[model samples]
Target: MPGGDISDLDKNRVLAQWLEWQLRQVRNRIRELEVQELKDKRRAEQARAGQRWKIQPQRSNVAALLHRGDCSLYSSEMGFLDREEAIIALAEPDIEACQICKPETGLVQT
Candidate 1:
C-alpha cells in the first residue's frame, strides 16, 4: 500500500483495458460513418435514377406535341415535365413516351 512497485501482470492488464476501450471507440465511429455514407449513397442513386425517366416535352416548330424524351438530351424547343407529373404529361396530346426508355410503361396500371 505504500510504495513504488506495480506488478508486470497489473501493468499488462491496465494496458489491455485501455487498448480495448480505444478499439471500441474507433469501431463505433467507423460504424456510424459507414451508415451515414450508405444513406448518402442511396440518396444519390435515387436522384440519378429519377433523372433517367424525367420526361421532356417534344414539340414541333409549330408548337404541336411530337413525343417526350429524357432530360439528358433535350431540344431547346421542348419543355421539361416534372417527375411527379410525368404520367399526366405523357397523356397530353401527341406526347408519346420515348421509343427507347418507355417512361409510360412504368406508370401505374390504373
Candidate 2:
C-alpha cells in the first residue's frame, strides 16, 4: 500500500517468493544430509555383516570354534559369548578383550 499499487488483494507476493526459495534450499540440504545418513547406515550394516564372533585362525575346515563353555576366546568374537565368557575370553593368552566392553576388569580370574 505504501510502496505502490496493491500487487494483489493484499498478499505479499515478493515475501512469499523469497520464503519459497529459502524453503527449497532447506529441503535440498535436508535431502543431501539424508543421503549421507543412509550411506553411513549402509556402511555400518556392511561392516557388521563382516564382523565375526570368532576370529581364531582355523587350522583346518573342521577346526572347532571356541565353545560357549570355554571362557577364553578372541576379542573380535563376542556376539555369542555372555558377560562371564567375555571376561574369560580376555584372560586367555591369545584372545584380546574389547577395550570398550572391558571384559577383564570386573571378571574373577580362576
Q: lDDT scores for all predictions?
A: 0.60, 0.54
The best candidate in terms of lDDT: 1
Q: Write the per-residue lDDT of candidate 1 for residues 1-110, one digit (tens) a residue.
A: 23978888889999999999999999999999999999999788656554544444445643223233333444433344555577676667756555555566656375
TM-score of each: 0.48, 0.40
User: Candidate 1: lDDT over CA atoms?
Assistant: 0.60
> Per-residue CA lDDT of candidate 2, range 33-108, in tens?
9999999997886455332233344454434343332234443434555555555665566655444433344454
Candidate 1 regions with alpha-carbon error over 4 angstroms: 54-110
Give the least accurate 10-residue stretch of model 1, judged by summed lDDT. Answer: 62-71
When summed lDDT is taken over every stretch of 10 residues in candidate 2, the lowest stretch is 62-71
